[model samples]
Structures are given as structure tokens and as C-alpha cells.
Target: MSAWAADRQRSRVRPGDPGWPSDVSWQQLNQQVGGALIKVESPIAACVEAPTSAACAQLFKSLRNPYFIGDDVALTQHLGWVDAWTSKPSAYAVAARNASDVAAAVHFARRNNLRLVVKGGGHSYQGTSNAADSLLVWTRRMNEIRLHDGFVAAGCGGHVAPQRAVSVGAGAVWAQVYDAVTTQRGAYVQGGGCTTVGVAGLVQSGGFGSFSKAFGTAAANLLEAEVVTADGQVRVANACTNPELFWGLKGGGGGSLGVITRLTLRVHELPEKFGAVDMSIKAASPEAFRRLIGLFIDFYGKRLMNPHWGEQVRLQTNNIMRVSMLCQGLDRGAAQHAWQPFLEAVSAAPGDFRFESSPVIVSMTARDYWVPTTLKRALGLVKVDDRPGAPISNMYWPGDQLTVGEFVHGFDSAWLPAALLRDDQREALSDALFASSRQWWISLYFNKGLAGGSAEAIDAAKDTATSPAVLDAFALAIIGAEEQPAYPGIAGHEPDLARGRRAAQGIARAVAELRKVAPNGGAYVAESNYFEPDWQRAYWGTNYPRLQAAKTQFDPEGLFFVHNGVGSEDWSADGFSRKA
Candidate 1:
């Protein structure tokens, strides 16, 4: 069931609402479902008839992620705020509850010959989740998490496959039921990014976490997977079942081998209320910023060899910047002591500045946070449209980590709309900033340790794909709102899509540069810094050919072809480009 599906009746919308699933399209599609595919009638029929629906109760079709089901104009609002994100139309969404749902979607797409896209939380900037015209298999409703057996199994299987055989296993998104008595019912499916990211997609990118150095990446911890091949057969993929596929998922990436349903992962005993700290500072000059950023590099080096040290810093790309910091340790006092040097560095600044520094223990268990509904509910933001659009393009800071093509030595780009950035800064200087309760704002994320987080575990053979040099990973985001406005003219709906392309290039550059610095820059399966196909080999290194071979064996029919899908046209047996 979708976490956001309150009730059919409660979700029912009246006439003035956004894209209220018109009887026209749904009815037509149901009638002409092609050949063997089942003809789904109402929302309930669509739910139960779904392939993955068998794993859970039939009452879940309406279920969706709490983040996905906002007002009609929410997408447009976000588009306005962002330059690279895609704002999907909700009517085309499938609220999958398990692996079976993904299987059903694949079966239906193949039978009906419709293009398909597998989605977890749809956090990608390239908008790969919302293809121009394709069947969207969304795993948002498959958010049910629990522990099972010695492995962890998601209520719905939404894991990603490995991109290249040499990369890693095909695990993406995150979470599962853990069965170890020591772990109780908890799982170690290692989720990436916010809780919203899927279990399957995260592990594919090499998950970065505070415990990565200790546990290895989420991919290193994986044991097995249940996959739905392109031909529609369900099978197990692992060192035993399909060793190549498993190898691909390790450090490889998702969206390659097949659609993952359930993941069998190695679970660990976690500590309660791990020590936490947060701090921020304003810079006086560019020299100070570099000095501070350079100081951080040293701490990063020490933390790499030290098992107990954990730290994250957020640096502004602008000349005059604000710094936000977080640190974690075995205990509060321990963390405070470890952070003293950083605090002293701030005091040694060339000029005086007010700083927010403190020590506070944070709750760590994975409990859902109840965000205040606030006015987003009061007036029903759907009550407005002209002001809505996708959020702005965001820049990420990998701290010291870099990629194969991206070089931070002289990195610079203005992802924000030029007008918007100038206006905001000028307004701030004038002591006036735009005020809108529903407006979306950019947020910086700081995570210590690349996917290969802690140094606790060392599997030389398994650690080949992993690296020890990377100390942190970070990303920028627009917390709320959908599309934002660029121009009132054709740009609003023209779908230029240049922003997505540019953002992808920028990320690619960063990743490329990192690959140059660290012979082994620690891979994070969850972060897919976009790279052009020609340059993709840089990210995968020696893993490309193996993935091509698997594609030839599994999808020879070439029945599946979609934009940004995967594989080149030459590899497709049927002359269809997987990423066409």
C-alpha cells in the first residue's frame, strides 16, 4: 500500500483539482491493453492486477510516497525552483508495493510494447525517473521496511542492477527485513541520501555513510538479490546464482542487469543515539575560505586512518561563504574534544564573525518524521499555478572526492538562474528577501566518508572496487515545491531540457576530477553523477565490457528501449537502443 494513500475517498478530488485522472485516458488504456496483459479497470483493479501486488495486501494500489502526492500545481512549483529536475505528471504513476509490481509493469510494458522507467524516490537531477513518454514503474509505495531471515527484504522489491560487472552488484535504493537475532528485526540494506531514496537504487552507486569505512559500502555488505530479467522470469542473482550480475551491482550501478525485487544484505549491530554535533560560520574573505577548506582536508586524512573519527563540512561555492559543519563520535564528550581544533581554527580567522557552534546528541533510529503540514494544506497550494514550477538546478560538493571527468582545481558554474541568483543576493544586501510560505529553498547535505565509510572492515579482494581516499560526499537540494518559472512564455511548457543536460555535465566533471586525484576514489552507488556515454568508461574503469555481455545474453530480443534506459544500440540484439 502507498504510504501516502490515506483513503480512496479522502484522495478523491473535485473538478478544479490538478490532473484528476480523467476517465478518457484511463478507460481507453484499460480497453486496449494490447495482448496478454491484464485489462485494469478502476484504481483498485490496477492495484490488484499489478504483478508485484501479490506480495502485499490488494488494498495498496492507492499507496504512494508522502512526498509524491502533493497538490496539482506542486510539480510546476518545483520546476520553477529547479533547472535540471523533471516534474512528472502523477496520472502516469504506478504505486508499486513490491517486486511483483515491478514485474507486472515490465510484463505489461513488454507485452504492450511501451517503454518503461523504474523509479525509486526520483531524486535524480536528469529526470531519468520521468521519461518523456514511457511507463513509469514507481517503487515509492514499496516503502515498507522490515528485517527478514539473515537478509533484509523490502515489502516491494525496488533495487537497481549493477551498471558494469567490474563496478559492483546491482543493488539500489535501500532497506530490508533483518533476521539476525543479534540485529533483532533491523536490516542493513544501507539506504542512500534521505529516507526517501529507494533501497534498490542507493546501493548501486556505492553508498557513503559514517559507518562506510567500518562496514564498506552498502554494496560490499550485500549477499544476494531477487531479480526480474528482461524476459520476465524471476530469478536469484548473487555470487552463486549469477556471479557476474552480483559483481556488477557491487560498485557498478543500477538500471542495468534487471529490476531488483528483494535484497539479501548483511546486517550489523548499530549503536543507539550515536554522538552528533552541528556548527556553521561565515567567511571573511576568499583566502579564509580556502584556508578553512584546506584545514578540512587534514581532518579528512586523519579520520580516514582513525576508526572513531567522523566529520562533515558544508562549504559555500561563492567567494563570501557560510560554513555548516557536523561531527559524530562514540560519545558526546569525545566528539566535542575531537572538534576542538576545528573550533579553534574558526577563532584564528583574520576577522571576527559570529558562529553557531554546539554539541548535541541526535536520535539515530529510522523513525519517520512528521513534517508540519503548515499552510501547504491550508489554502491547498493547488489554489495557485502561475507561481509553480520545478526547483532550480543544484551544485554538489564532494569535499575532497572527485570523479573521472570532473576537476575541482578550477571548478565554477552558476547552476541557478542568473536573474534569480542576482536578485536574491541583491535583495539580501538590501535587507529584503522574497517571502512566500510555499516557496522552495536550497539545502546542503554533508555526509562523512565516501560509500567506503569506516575503516573497520578490509576485504582486499572485495575492496578492489572500494577506495580509502574519499572522506566525504555532499549534495544540494530544494526541500519542497515542484517546478519553478523560468520565463512566462513557451519555456514554461516547451521542455527545452537544457538545464538537465548542463547539470549532468557539471556532475560528470566533478566525478571525473575525483577519479584523477585518488587512484581509488571510493565509489558511492547512490550518487550517479551524470557522465556522457563516451566518458562513462572512466567511471566504470574496467567494468563496461562485462555489462555489455550480460545485456547481450538477457535482453537480446531488444524489446526494451527507452531514453536513458541503459546499454548502447550496438549491444541490443533487436536494434533498439536501451538508452535511446
Candidate 2:
């Protein structure tokens, strides 16, 4: 056998070998590519009963926490890089400039028995973009955008390029797309509020935005995609070719079946400048808070049937309920006219409250509209190097007006105050939670009473893998502890395992309590609690079987996996490895 092959054989201990890359093994691998193909890893904990080698000890001491992330090559090659919220590190990272590069990376990962992670924008909340002991394929170098007839094709890593029908790269952020399309193409795309969020991840996660009422969801607008499946074959998925894959790609949740390299999205014309009414109401006491919540829910019920309307309601720890709205195709006058009923409801509320109106013609294209409100401000309070992921849950209001009002009052009155921490504990966690308060925020996307048969309407009969609950939903609700980490979904990486367990359990309790009100409703897969009891039922509902079938066909080897993603239940949550 060759010297390198012999070295590799020697390196493989009988389940007791040192986890060290010998000099010979490194030399041989590097020589094949004229240089290092893989860098030395930081000294991770060795498996039990590992063989002790002097060289391994030296390597460990000399190169503590060895990782390629800071190397010059890594800096240039890595596209939009980010680590985990818990600071978990990937074993190695490789950049893909083309489909072939992606295929090569896949092959190398499989051969080396390394977990593979595909990162387009690196904005995954659950930290799926950076997996421990995994090979990360960075797609940032593949940035290229092309416009074609009737459609636009975007490289997965490229900036957003717009046409009459825009094509957005998977890595392209919402702000970039808005800037490219709004002025040049005279169109607006439905996307998340944050500018830095990736189009690919958002769309694949059942995304919605201000214009959702008029334009449907970002997933619903997906026209086609180019993907590299588990077997390392580059494939095209659309209405006609690979239709099943296309359906799965629409909103089966990101990183499930394959690495999406490009996306073709359907863009709509700008109906009118976006207009909204901003109103804030504060209650003098807890009883007033209940009344304010009831009024807000009543307003939501009134406007829920308007396809061109959407509302964001926030219940703050200081007993403040803020309501902001977006009325697509409505001017300032039209919005005022439409909001009269809501205004009346608030005015007639029983409580000591003050309603402050900051009505402005906030153009959607303007910076003010794009700025994230409470969540962003809250994120800024406990500033860290990188923005952490949030723990979130989606609740749909399936009740009538009276039922919704009752549900809202009950949740705000019964659950929120009870779950809040005492003043002493609140002070300790104040940085993590902006106000040391427990808050529940809801953004209701009026999907009902939409102009039926309109191209923009969400069709339940459509084959996309997005949750069936989204089509029949009334609102998206998120409840979180203010004094906790801003990204509510991340239970946190406590050094004490027991402490971590308690923290997670606390979050699970809150989630369970909130779920009680929306028992019959489904959740948006993208912004949901990580510890969802029956995730399949909560996220995909009855559509889980079809999504699973598609996953089996495209990735029978279970190459691509993410937490809470389709077929992810088959794997262990701890390492995403196959279950015994």
C-alpha cells in the first residue's frame, strides 16, 4: 500500500485511536491538490479510550481551538459567514463557486464521514448553517444574477437582480431585492421586515411580510429552483420538471432535501405606495391591559377579512399595547377611512388608557417602514457580536370575533402576568430581556376574504409544501420572555447541563400555554418554538406525509438534515445523526 494509505490505516484505531491527523496523512492529502485541501481542526474532545500520541498532544497544545474561520483563505472564500448562537464551531468550511464545486464538496463530506451543512445567507435562526463537526459548503462565491425572458435566474449567492419578474438569489437579502426592484422594475416583492434575512431561507420557511395580503407569501411566489441533491447531481425543479421536488422546495423548510443554488421568483407590480397607521395605547393597570388587548383583538377581527390589510400588535411588559398596520394600495385618506372602526373600538374601551396616534404616510420604500420595531429594538438592548436566533411560536386565531376577543383577553390576563419573573430575577436578566417583562406579540396577516381566484391568493390545492394552516390562518403570534435572550428560540448554551435543561423547560412551558388558545390552528414553520410537541402537526399539518415522501426520493441517504425540517424526526436532535 502507498505510504499515505498505510498512514490512514494506522490512524484508524480500533475505536480507541487518537483523533489526530498525522503529518503523513496531511502531506498526502495536500500534495494531491498542490496544497492543503483540509485544515487541521481545533482539539475537540477525544472519543473515550482514545490512544495517546505525543504528536497529538503537541498539536492540541500548539493549536488550541484550531479552525479555518480566521485564515485569509477562509475570510475570502466564506460567504456571509456566521457561527452558532451557542458558539458551536464547524469542523471545516469549503467555498463553492459553481455546481461542480458543490458536488465535489458533497462527495468529500460523504467520503470523510463528515456532516455536511449548506449555507447561502447564514441567517438560519436554529443555527443549522453552522453544525458541529461538519463540513460547511459556503455558496457566497457563486454570486451571479441573470435576467431572461418571462423570468429571471439568480445564482444562489448573488445579489438580488430584478426584472418585470424578478429573480432573487438565495443569499440576497430583502432590502437588496427591494432596492433593485422597486425603482427599476416598478415592483415590490413580499419579504420579511429585516433587510439582512436571506430570500432562500425565508421563502422555504413559509415566509410572509407587509404585502402578504396582496401578493401572498414569498414561498408562493417561487417559480423555479436549481438544486444539488444528496447524490451530488445538479437538478432543475419547476412546474413541469421534477414537480415533486418543486413542491417540496416551495416551503418544505430549508436544508431538508438539497442545497438550493438558484431561485426564480414571481414579482408583482407596486399597486401603490405602502401606507399605515401607528397607534400606541398604554394601560394604567393590569385590568386596563386586558381591556387594551381586547380592543386590539376586536380591531383585528374587523380587519381580518380585508385582503389588503395587515396589523402588528404588541403587548409590552409596561402594560402598553402598540398597534401598527400596513394597508396595501391605500393612501393616507383611505387608511384613515378604513381604520375608523378600529379607532372607535379603542376609543370605546373600558379602562384608563391613552391612545397616541403617529399617523404618517410611511412609504414602504422608505427606511422607516423597513426598520424593525420592537423586536429589533429589543435585540439591540443586550448587544452581542452577532445577532442571536429567536425562539418563536406562531398562533392562528380560528375563532369568531367574540371568541377571538375572549381568547386574547384570557391569554393576556391569565398567562402573561403569571409567567413573568419576579422583580429580583427580572433585574438579573434585564439585559437579555429589554424590559425584564414577558411579552406576547402578534402580527395578523389577513388571509381570509381575499379576492378569490386572484393570482395572488393562497390556494390550498397548490402542491407547495408550505403549511396548510397558513392558508386558513388569521394571525401569527409570538410570545417570549423579555429578560431572556432576545432570540427567544435559543434556550441558551448554559455551561451547567441542568441549568440548560431548566431554561429549556421554562420555554417549553410558555410555548404549551400559548398553544392552548390556538389548539386547532397550525403554526408557521419558520418562526416556531424549537420544542414543538408534535412539530409535524404544528408546522406542516397533514402535509407531512407528502413532504416525507419527497425527502425519501431526493435524499434517501438522509444527506441534508435540519432541526424541525421535514423527515428530521428520524434523526436525533442532539447531533442530527441517525438514531439507533
Candidate 3:
């Protein structure tokens, strides 16, 4: 075996380990970062100590606010996954405010042989950003967003031409970025659907948004990045410099290869309009539901399989199909026109299907979609942060509110190949959807797949470390379940283990149904099954080997690790020890 391989066959130092850093060392490192070191604690620690205190009451209320959870170094958007992982505060956190601070933290962690965790938005459903007895590099204080009319990568001034782009600090979230780039500047940058997701994490995980079909993934749009690698060097990674590292940073999974300080992403011209088609149709019987699924699949394959449409369609166990799809570059009339055939078909079959509510097909100026006032007055579709001194612009989708501090029971996803949409294969695909829904509700996120995207979009995604399966898949089928704000040892907020376990089994069965049609499908790294047996292939496909090489080159000693991230196979499940 190789020297590095042999070296990894050992345990990592933990809190009680003899090699653990001393207080003096920690203090010295804290001084290096301008006294930004924080002793991390559970968000509910105050509640655990005094359940009846006003502070505890306030803490419970704050848990529902994603921004509040994100700002805290100890918490994650997802509290935990039942029977799998729980949110745990690190021993200490370095509240990094700049690349220098990040590098200082990295150097300290490496020197002390510490298990390091990196958190920007802290939204990892897999609990990747949370670990007990580890040091956290918290980038929340580093938020800074700047736009460039024209920008070029470092060391490629002559080779690559300048392009319109936006540079965002690692801690900056999608809402903040969208407000600047789209609402204010009248341009578009591909990002995650959840507005508060950290830009750095999403890009590194192959981000998808409502309009990804038009602009491609956030990773594919990356122009450059400032990353602090494990060696304590702050390096600029782009196509022109540290090319291999740059490739790995795109869709290679976050907190593995390096700590991103900032990213510059290519910007595209904002479409004239952005729109949505919201409707729910409940079939009267199982036979009707099967027909409804078949009809929708046919409609999607024929009319909606293109760059103009994105978002999702939900197939529920109640024999209901919900359409929450979005569109861009199209006016209200055109958007409605595109759906007329499907709507007519459902209407004609009124005996078999019934509308849950009046179908909504609405369109608005693309620039206004993320504007707080527009969202409030025009759509009435946002939940604003009510905390005192919160920015008026601090708003999130109501749809995202349910999972703010959820403890997931189970979550799994698989890419459904575009071929499944073919006329000859649509029946099998429809049958799979119906069967999956019977087990658990399944959502097909069209934007997460790249098959019907523009050639430029597909070409760019191919260069990233994401699974090749994504290039041919029309949608990503996701099945998941969660409960509100549950944490172990938190008196009344303890997780519902019995209920959670049942939901987990249902989720597994649901995904099994999808697997019948897509048995060899690859899964998205950022949002996939936590207990994926063959994670390397599920996450990166053939790209795993290349990503592994990059991880070895940059983080040879495995100082940086996250659950299921590249090169993590060498380490134990808890990431505190290497596998023998």
C-alpha cells in the first residue's frame, strides 16, 4: 500500500485523546484570528439548563427561523436525521471573517491534528457541518457580495476573456446574492431554490434553482474561487490556475477538498419574465391516479422538456398530483398556453380527477421575483424574518418554512433518465411513479437534471465533478420525511424516534420503487440517501476517481473531512478515525 494510504489506517485525535490541543495553543490560535474564536454550544443549551426561562422560550422560537439557525455556529438547518445523525456542537469555532482568518484556522487544525468542520449556511441534511469535539471554521461573518461588469480568472488574462460575473463570500446565501444580481442589477446567476442556502456550499455541490434549466447549475457557472486548502495556503482556483482543484471544487461536495473563502460565478442576462404554474389535482381512484400520472408524464416529455421550464411535480399517496413548476423567458399568456393541453385533458376527465383549488398560472418581471416588496404585494408568498433589527429584505419562501429546523427521518434521491420519458417507456415510468407514491410522496425536481438544458449548460456541467448521469436525466426523484425542531436531551423537543423510524422505512420503500425503473441511477451528492451503500458511484459516478486524486493531492493527511465527502471512505463513519 502507498505511504499515505498506510498512514490513514489510524484513528484521528478526539477531545480526550493525548494529542488534543492544549488551552494555551487554542488561545494562541484565537489571538491569530483577532480573538474570533468561539466556544460553541447547542442552540438549546440554555433551554436544557432552564426549561422555563424566557431565554429558552426565545430560543425555541428562533429555531423556526433559518437565518437565526444559520448565524449560530452551533446549529444546522436540519437538526438531524433520526437514528442516523444528530446536530452536535463542536468544541470550538473560529469565526473567520476573511481568507487570512480561514488560513490561520486551517493551519492550527492541521498542526494540532484536529478534526475540522466547515460551516457556511450549515444546511447539510447529512449533518456534515456538525460534529462533537471538533473545531469549526465558521464563515458566517465573511459575507460580502460584489458584481463585475467584466471579470477574468487570475493567470488567464490573455487566454480567457472577461465576462460579467458576481463574486460572493462563502457565507453569503442565495437570497442575498439573488437580491444583488437579479433584483437590483437585472441579471441572473444560477443558485439553489432555498434562498438562504450558502452560496459556497451549493456551488460546490452542483446547485440547482427554479431556472437552472435556462442558466445551468451554480457549479457549472463558477468562474473562480478563493479557497483555503489544508496546507494553510489561500489559493485562487479557476480554469486558468490550479485547474484540477478548480474542477474538484465544482460539484465535488463541500468541506472536503478545501474551505472556500469566496466564489465568482458567471452571470447571464435576466429573462424578461419569470413565472409559475401551481395546481393540485386529486384523482378519484387509483386507476384515475395512474392515468393522471401517465398524462402528466406525456405532457412533460412533449411540451415541458426544455430550457424554458423547471421546478417540480409531486406525486402523493392520496392519489393527488401537485404541479409547482416554474418557467422563465416566457410571458403569462405563453406560460399558460404551454400548459393548456394538460389542463384541458384533466378538465375533460373531471369524473376521474378534481382540482384541489383554482389552478394558478402567473408571471412577473424576472427582476421582481426576489424583490421583497414584490414578493409581498404581488405573490404574497414569503415568510419574513420577524426578529427585531432584521433586514426588511430578510424573507424566505413559505414552502421552505417546514424544513427550517426539521429533524429528517429519511431522505433519498435518484436521477430518472430522460429515456424514461420516451413514448415506449412512459408506461413503466408512470407505473414507477404511482408505486413510489403509494409508498411515500415523491417529488420530481426537473431543474436538478440537465438532459433538456441548453447545449452550453450541458457542456459546462460535463466539465464538473457531478455524476455523468445528471447529463441525461430529466428529473431527480426525491423522497423524504421530517419532523419539527427535535434534538436529543432537549426535554420536550426530543425526536419522535418511533414515528421517525416508520417514516424512514417508507422512504426506503418509496426509493426502492423508483429504483425498479432506474436501477443504476446516480444520486446527487448534496441531497442523497445518508446510508447509500455504494456512495462513491452514487455521488460522482466515474468522476469519483478524479475527485479522490484531487482530495489526496490537496488534503493528503485527511485533515478536512465530512460524512460521505470525497476521500472520506478512508476515515471511519464518525470521521474521528481512519479505517484499517
Candidate 4:
């Protein structure tokens, strides 16, 4: 069956659910959304049990050139970019080229009291990033990166390439930005893990990277921001300037803070040459298992290790795991030297180990930062782009003591390597590494020495959301299924509850553990799964109260509700009921 038909049968909820009203209340909601923003329209008239003859009008006016409009015309002047993780579409969007445009939209929404969704350069798990029924404002066109007064001032309404970075910035488009800075400009940045995510999500969510252990989280490098408040006024915020907002935005999930228009970031020097490597283990024997886990523990305990060495391991099942090591130094040879210990630890046994390595050239000038995550996040990447399934939820993984064996061991069934693999590319890489293992694959990222290499200093900073555990890294589980579980009533239709629940339970366990390790630990907002609001509060803990206050003070009308954003009511004492 076609993907759309198959999904319709499995969606968690549909438009016509009882909660989706068609009465006067619905009409009133429609009217509010209609005039919420200038040049914006509403789609309430199209719903069944509708009111009058009028439908949400197309956003364009009588001008010969038609640009910007409702969901139908979103493809023209995109106010939002569709997320690649899931097929969930954004209802309406706006490409705000200037801050004034942002002001206009905010003011319009305030006047009409409509719900507004803000679009960054990435995706949300469901319809949070972009949706069909809500108002959207795309901020990709605001791409202008400049170096001014020893600081990098980036535009907000659109994607802004970083002004500078010592390594890389948080909320950066990993691969793309890495390629641009290192490959093109000979500079590099330490961004939030994923290459296709966004800076907005990263910065607000207290971004962490390989260098976080070295230089600290992306938030540590931030200097200031020009944000469009709910009041439709732009303000430059920092420890000195709206310090409270600055503190909240530092790691408090972007949407919750305000519409960030520009980010004044700290930039740094890049490494001369970097090493990227991925290794796999069969671990068919006890010795192999001991070596794998032993090496992991040793590396975690190392003190002489490179300040730039960043390593990660994923043991799928059967004691098999993939280890990725990155070290940034003056030379690739030196990087290799720092990585030698882990390599030796895993390759001690024959037929049980396989590894690959690549050299990453570093930037020497205009150090640090990049954005424009993925093509799907860009207007150009949307049409004919391949945005697959399952929305990515930002989660708080605050601990470092997790084992893949535990997750798969208790499943009461065999685990497939395919399940752990994020996409086809990883599968190919895995095949090239293993001749016998057919059930799993390892994903890899090079550009080691993120910040200072290990997460040791991060623990000291305690700067992340909820004061996350300082030593933990990040993981991105890319899957191709969008529908949640339900009793299968049709072909290819199965409930995602059990599976989703398992994922949630595992994440919940991780969060609980992190709180124990580094209570300040938190994950990027884009990675949130939207399973529990309270857990989310834990992810953005210390800042939730302040964010709510910002909403109450700036947007008392509560007309703005960006997708995946922390809603004002959700933070209120009464809001606790929504989590249930």
C-alpha cells in the first residue's frame, strides 16, 4: 500500500477526533488563528461541521507575485521546513526575512490571539516543527553570518552561518557546517551531535558535543542573543542584558524562551588535522566481551587521554558493539596515537575486531560554528526530499551507565542489527566491517577533540539543563516508522504503544540515572520524544519556571505555541494535569 494510506491507518490521532471541535468553539478558534499574523490565514472553514461559506484564505494578497500563504502555498515562500524524521507535515509557515517581519507576526498573533508555531532549521517528532492546522513562521531565510567586534553576530529569522568558533558551535548543522568550516574555510565547530538538526534547538537545550568535555557545551560559548519577545519587541539578552531571559535561553529550549533572531556566539580556533574512526567487535567469546567492556571502562576513566579525544560505543546485541573514536590534535598521527589504546583493547582477539579510520582537516582561521543542518531543513531540501518516519524527541539522558545488552536481553526475542541501524548508509558501512554478523551495524562520526576531547570539564561546569550528568554523550536513533502502536485493524497497521512504551521506559531510566550522576544533564529539544511532560521539565528543569514567567509577561494572551515548544500552561501548577 502507499505510504500515506498505510500511515492514515496507524496515526495516533486524526483531525476528526472528538477533541477536535466543529462547533462555535471551533469557529472561534478559527477566527483567532485567521488574523493571528499579518498575511496569514486560517483553515478552520475547511473542517467538517463547519460554520459559514468562508474557508481559511490563501496567505497571498492581490500582488502580481504571490508569496507566503497557508499550508497549500507554504511550498512557495516556506514559513517552515518539514522535518525529515517523520512525514508529519507543518500546517502553515512563514519565511520571515527580517526582525520587523517577526515583530509584525507576533503583533498580529497577539491581536488575533491565534496559536503560532516557530520553525527552526530542523525537525520535531510529530507535527511540532511544521503542521497542517496551526500557524507557522519559518526562520530559514534569515541566513546572514558576520564577524563583528570580536564576536559572531548571526541572523535569526533565517539560518545564519556562524560568525566564528574555537571549535564548532552548538545547534550547528554537523556535517554541512563541518564541511563548510573545515573543508572550505579551514575552520571547524563542535555542534550539537546530529548533522541534520538545528542550532536553535541545540543552544536552548544546552548543547553538548565531543569538545564539551574539553571546552564545554555549546551554551558555554554563547555570548548574547537578539530575540523577538512575545511582546513583538526585539531585545539583546545576556547575563548583563535581560539576564533572566539570557539564563533561561542558555539551556532552556528555544521556543520556550522567545523567537531568537540572532545569536552572538563565541568562536575559537580549529584543529590542524583530525582523526575519525569506527570499530566493531563480534564478541563471540567471553574474552572478547571482557575486552570490549573493559576498554570502555578504561577509556571512561582515562586522565592522560587527549583533551580533544571524543569516543562513543554502541553494543547492539550478543555482546557485539561499535566503537567510534575522534581525536583532534596538531596532526592525524598524534590523533591516532591517542586513539591507539582503545583500538588495541578491542583488536586483541582475532575475527572479533574490525575498524576503519578517516582524516578530517581542521580550520585554522575564523574558528568555530556553522548551521543549515540538512536539505530537508532547507527550503530546497523539502520538495522531492526524502523525509522518512518517526518524530525525533529531545530527551534528557543524564547518565553514562547504560548497556545495549540490557535493552535487548530482556526483549524475549532476537534482536536485529537492522533495528539499531539508523539508515541504509550505516548498513553498508557495517557490511564492509563484518563478514559474519548480519544482525547489526555501527554508525560513525569523526572530528574528535570536540572542545577538550572528553566530558571531564563539563561535569564541573554543571551548565546544562537540569544540571545533566557531565560525562554522558548523545545518541540519535533514526527509524523509518511514523505510526504509533494500536491494535492492528488493517495491513501494516500495528499499535506503537508497546514499542514506544519500551523506548520511553528506557529513556525514563536514563533520565533518572543522569539526574543521579549529573543532575544538570539535558538533551537538545529536537531529540525530545514527547512521552512525558514532567520528564521534559526535568530536561529543562531550572529554566521552566522562568520560561513560563516570560510567557506570562510577554505573551499573556498565549497566542504563540511553537511545535515541540514548552507551553505556558504546561508549566503552571494546573498544567501538571496535561501530562496525564
| Best-fitting candidate, scored by lDDT | 3
Q: In candidate 3, what residue range of length 10 has the lowest lDDT sum?
A: 3-12
Task: Supply candidate 4's per-residue lDDT for 249.
Answer: 73
**lDDT tens digits by residue: candidate 4, 128-237:** 44444444566655555544424433333233443554322222333444455444566545465444445665666666565554555666666677788888898877
Evaluated with TM-score, which candidate comes out highest? 3
Task: For candidate 4, report its TM-score.
Answer: 0.59
How many clashes (backbone atoms < 3 Å, residues ≥3 apart in a chain or on different chains) does model 2 have?
A: 9
- Specify the poorest-scoring 10-residue window by lDDT in model 4: 404-413
Clashing pairs in 3: none
Q: Rate the local accuracy (lDDT) of all candidates.
A: 0.39, 0.53, 0.90, 0.43
Model 1, range 1-580, lDDT digits (tens) per residue? 5533433212223233452335564444444432212221223223234534543232221122223222111121122113333344333544455565567666655654444555664444334444434455555444443344333223323454332111122222221222121133332333342333445665654554544544555666666777777877777767656777666666555556577666656655544334445556555655555555445444434442344433343444342223333332355556666667766776776484336444343433322111112343253411111223521111112221112111111111111111212333333311111111012122323343432234444452154232222333322111211212221122113323454345434444443433332323333223332222432343344555665666667766554432223463333222222232
Candidate 2 local distance difference test against the native: 0.53
Indicate whether candidate 1 or candidate 3 has the larger TM-score: 3
Candidate 3: lDDT of 516?
95
Give me the runs in candidate 1 sitting further than 4 Å from their true place.
Answer: 1-66, 69-85, 88-101, 143-146, 149-189, 303-311, 318-329, 349-535, 558-566, 569-580
Higher-lDDT candidate among 1 and 3? 3
Query: Judged by lDDT against the true structure, how good is candidate 3?
Result: 0.90
Arranged by TM-score, best first: 3, 2, 4, 1
Q: Write the per-residue lDDT of candidate 2 for residues 134-230, one digit (tens) a residue.
A: 6667665555544443553333224344344566555555655665666445666667654445677877876766656567777777777888888
Ranking by lDDT: 3, 2, 4, 1
